[model samples]
Each structure stands twice: as C-alpha cells, then as structure tokens.
Target: MQGKAGFWNLSNKLTLFRIGVIPVVALLLLSPGRAPNLVAAALFLVAAITDTLDGYLARRRGTVTPLGKLLDPMADKLLLVTALIFLIPLGRVPTWAVAVIVARELAITTLRGIAASRGVIIAASWLGKVKNLLQLAAANLLILHHPYFSIDPHRLGTYVLYLALFFTVWSGLDYLWRYSRL
Candidate 1:
C-alpha cells in the first residue's frame, strides 16, 4: 500500500518532473546555436540530477512506491536515449555507439524481466550505476558539443563515452554471467 504521500509525493513528483522536461530539452537541442545547446545541457543536467535526488528522497522519506520504481527507470531511459538519438542528427555522436548503448540497455532490461518471471531478482550492480553516471556526463558534454572557454566538450564527451561503453559492456556481461543460472 502506498503511504499517505501516495503517488503525489515529492520523489515521484520529481520523477514526473524529469519526464515532463524531456520533450522541452529535446526541442531545445533541435534548435541551432550555442545558446540552445547550452540551455538543453543545463536542463538535461537538472533532469539527471533529479534522478538521484528522487531516489534519495524516496528512500529517506519512506515514500518509495511501486509506481516510482516503474517510472524512474523508464524516465531515465527515455531521457538518455532521446538525448543520444538527438545528438546523432546534430553530428555530435556516432550511430554505432548509440546502437551499442541502446542494445545493451534492451538486453539488460530483457534479462531482468526474464529473471523476474522465474522468481529471481537481479538487483542493480555498482558497475551499472557507474555506467549511468558516465552516460549522463557524456550526454551532457556531447549535447553541449562545442568548445567553450578553452574546453572542448565534444572531445571530452567522446573520451568519457568510451569509458561508458566499456562499463556498459562489462556490466551487461557481468549481469549475464552472474544470473545465467536463473
């Protein structure tokens, strides 16, 4: 049963807020110019930050809900995947990289569902968390795309993305190796 906070709790609200801002960020990125990209990066960062904030708030306030659990991951995938796809058209990210990232996400998600069906719970791994952080950082940098004040966001983002891809493959294999018995 949900607590008194119910579905409208702050944490869930933040998750919903993250979902709500995704379209706005996408549209901002679609616009051409430094200002739009910068704004999109800022908004994307806010949404990503809320991902952590919402989880922390839910746990700390005892307001974790089934809906929250369901929406949080969905919101994250939508935001990150959308950003990556948008970045491709902007010439900010490579198609093959996005394909690998998407494939890993789908494979892991499918793996978890299969495990769940057999009465097993494959909990999130630390490497998975690190991958999320790396992806978020890369997406923000790649979205920003251009150099600013002696900082080249695209090159740096590409470097971070390589690390993210490494982690993504490692974590996916780790999950499969550990949970294949299920």
Candidate 2:
C-alpha cells in the first residue's frame, strides 16, 4: 500500500510537471527566427509526450484527482492556444483556423465551468476526444512546418485543422444543448 501510494504521488507530480511546461514550450516556439523553430518543435513534442504519459499514468495508477481533472484540460487548452496564436502571425498557420479553434475551446471551457459549478461532471464526448487528437496532430504538423516524405505538411495540417474545427463546433453545440436540457 505504501508503494502504491508512492507511485500515485509520483504520477500526480508528473501531471503537474506537464502543466507547468506549456508556457516554456510556448515561449520557445514564439521566439523569432527560423533557427529555433526546430528546437521549438522538439520542445513542443516533449510537452505533447508528457501530456500523453501523464494521463496514461493517472489512469493506470488510479490517481485521478479533482485537480488533475481541471488542470489536464486547462493545460491542453493553453498549449494548443498558445501554439496557434504564435504560429498564426509567423505565417505558419492561418488566422481564421486559429480563431475557429480558439472560439470552440473557449465555449467548451465555459460550459465545463458552468457544469462543474452545478456539481455536474461532464465526461469528454467521443467527438471531443477526436477533436483533441486532430488538434494535436495539426499542431505538431504545423510546428514542424510539415516536412514531407511525399506528403504536404501544410495541406495535411490544414485538413486536420478543418476536421478539428468541425468536431469542435459539433461538440460545443452538443454540450450546450445537453446543458440546456438539464
């Protein structure tokens, strides 16, 4: 039991670490000049890896906490939004795409806050999960500038972004409708 508790504690600490790294990764990505883009991309990749590992460890170890629940999504949103915002002006991503994604994130976050305040916990929908995956892929591709082993990174990123946007809109409306009915 002591060992289990220790493991769980470590898992929670890792989750916190993942949340804390987002800003540093964002700042690295935001730095001027192309030389650091690769470094920024690597940092972003590390941050993304931490995101996955933390969640997996939490579930596997049964270490989920209210703080984890809140911080996980919040960190994800911050990282993705910061990446989109920084990349837009760099000409690496489209402004409209970032706008749509940001709007969706904001709407869903607001709805989640409302639901939490009412003592209702909303599980992430399948569509929402897919949207997240696509968004992550898009961010990664955009950050790397889409180097191709015969595939166009920009076009693929654009396609994934659109898919993410579609799901984001759908999921947002679904949450809103569900909340209204409740």
List runs of model 1 lying over 4 Å from the truth: none
Q: How accurate locally, in lDDT, is each candidate?
A: 0.93, 0.75
Model 2, poorest ten-residue lDDT window?
A: 1-10
User: Candidate 2: which stretches are off by over 4 Å?
Assistant: 1-8, 31-35, 146-148
Total colliding residue pairs, candidate 2: 0
Best by TM-score: 1
What would the per-residue lDDT of candidate 2 be over residues 22-106, giving only the tens digit for each residue?
7776676767755566676777777777777877877787776766766777777887888888888778778988888888788
Give the per-residue lDDT digits (tens) of candidate 1, residues 44-98. 9999999999988998888999999989999999999999999998888999999
* TM-score of each model, paired residue for residue: 0.97, 0.83
In model 2, pairs of residues that clash are none
